[model samples]
Structure formats: C-alpha cells, structure tokens
Target: IVGLPESLHAEPLETTTVRLPRWVGGSYCWAGAYIAGELMRAEGFTDVRYVEADRSVDQSEWIARGETDFSVNFPPNQIASIDAGVPIKVLTGLHSGCLELIAKESIRSVTDLRGKRVGVDGFNNSRHMWLTLMSAYVGLDPVNDIQWVLTKDVKPTELFIQGKIDAFLGTPPQPQELRAKKIGHT
Candidate 1:
C-alpha cells in the first residue's frame, strides 16, 4: 500500500501519474489498474481517470466491491484475498529491495536502536519487516526491545517533524523530505 490520502481521488488519473508498490498480487492487484491507466495515457490516450487509494486494504476493498479496476500489492495479501474470494489478477513486480531502518539522530548502527520508539506505517508491512530484521540482527527482539508506533494515515515525514516518532522506516519522498528538513538522519 502506498498510504496516499483519500484526497487524491479528486485528481484525474493520467499519463503523468505513477503508482508505487513492491509488487503486484493478492488484494493489492487493483493498483495495477492505476499503472495501466498511466500507460494508456503514455500511449496517447487522454482524459483517463487517475486516482490513488489510501492503502492496499483500501484497494482490496475497492476491487471486491467492483469500484476499482486494478492495484499493486504483496503476494501474501493477494493470496489471502483470493482465498477469501475477491476476484483479482497479477500483472508484474514493479520494484524490489526491502525497507531501510532509519533513525532521527546519529545512531551510527542498528545496535543504537535499542529502546528507541520506531515508527512504521503498519504491522506486517515492508517497513515493519525491515525494522524487525534489523532489530533481530542486533540481537534485539522487535516486540520487546523497541516501542513500535504504527502511524497509518500520517506520513512518516510529518511524524518525524512533529517528533511523534523517534525513528521510522519509510520510502523515497518521505526519507528525502526528512533530509531536507533535517528532522532525521538515515
């Protein structure tokens, strides 16, 4: 799930739009429709509808209700959706590489994350997984060593700027924005 706000729906889906996700499968399949709409525009199509959903779950809901055409999502979630009887299809993997563990201060290494409050979009997400892997690598149990803060609708950069979270696992623009604000050091 991209975690874009619902406000994005008012905008049209056009060739200029780009949808981001780790892969295309499961409940997140409708995300591919957004990408396909973009491709159609690039091929000279126009007036296409380009709308961004809040999360993979939202996309899944849209697909199940027939309100959306496609999406991009993780394999596990997709499989679960299929088992639950949501009609969907796979397209292709958009990108790879797991999330990175980041901190708001100069921590130097993962070991420094002990006792830190880590912020992630949600549990079982790529960001959360990275935090878990990093924590385990440092001999810290993710469930016990750190306080995990799940900020679902709020952007990680905003949480970092507000000092609501000590560290976060996030993707591009948010991490880049953090650097621009000097709110944290990855």
Candidate 2:
C-alpha cells in the first residue's frame, strides 16, 4: 500500500471489467483485504462485487447463499458456519488477538466472569463468539457458567456502561471509547 496515491483509495473495491468474486465483505479490522480488492480492480478485475457486512457471521451467510465468493471471518464463526454446512472453506487467517474483553473492577479476570452477565449485540455475533472462546480458554462453560445479555439493536457498550452487564468484549472503537471514559478495566 506504500505510495498508493490518495485518489485510488477513494474508489476501492469498485465494480470493474474483471470479476474476482461476486460478493466480498470488509471489516474495519482488515483494511489490507480491501486494499487487495482495490489492487485487483486496478489490474482490470472490473466485475468484482463488494458487500458491506457488519459482522463476520453475515459474511458467512452471504457465502452460503451464493451471494459471496469469499470473505474474512473469525475462526469460531468460520467453524460454526462450516459445522452448519455453509459450503465455504478457510483460505487463510487474516489476524488474531484483536478482541479485548473489558469489565468493571468487580470482575478482575476472565475466570471471574463465571456466574456473571456479559453483554453482546446478539447471540453468535462477533462479540458473543469471541467471548465464548475466551470463556473456554479460561476453563469456563460458555453456555452454562456465564449469562449472555443481549442488547439486540442496542450496542453492548451502553449496557456495560449502565452496569447491566458484567463484561463485554468490544473489538475496537468501543474499547477506546471505554478507556477514554475510564469506565472499565480491560
């Protein structure tokens, strides 16, 4: 991406004369993937379609529906999709260790989450799935040992701030926002 002129970035993943995949989604976490798509378009892949997916699970579903040729997703969601027979395979991992689980002072560690309420936008979403793996990593039963608090359309951070949830694993801007407010410990 070095010296990639500013103007080129303005029109990333644009539909073109050549097609890479019918549908591909982007997450803010992986800007490189988007850049790759842009480069492909620059190289004459004019027919590549772009999709905006808020969560990796959505990307998996789009793939299952034949609306997406490829996508990037977390391993837990990827495995779940495959187990659910989504007919997609992992080409490679983009990255990991980006999820940060934040909690109030009452909760000091991952193990402390047992018998506690954790917030998520919904079940099986990015936050919930990541938190599930984290719970298992600490030898806790994700399904039974912890209470999953769903905010539904409401962002979990709001619930976490209001003390409705004991903890939440926010991906990016939420963590930064929480840090600025000095609201929780991560």
* Best candidate (score: lDDT): 2
lDDT of 2 by residue, 1-186 (tens): 888764554545444543123223334766755677787766657565665543434667877766566776677778888898888888876547677888989899899999999888778766688888888999999999998888888887888888899898877788899999999989
How many residue pairs clash in model 1? 12
Prediction RMSDs, each to the true structure = 11.1, 6.0
lDDT for position 54 in model 2: 38
lDDT tens digits by residue: candidate 1, 1-186: 389653344555555433332332323334455566666665555555544444556355566665555555545456556777878776654335434456767666787777877788888765576578778987988898888888889877777778787888766556666677676787
Which regions of candidate 2 fall more than 4 Å away from where they truly are? 1-27, 42-44, 52-57
Error of 1 at 46 (Å): 11
Residue pairs in clash, model 2: 16-46, 16-47, 17-46, 18-45, 18-46, 18-47
* Steric clash count of candidate 2: 6
TM-scores of the candidates are 0.52, 0.77
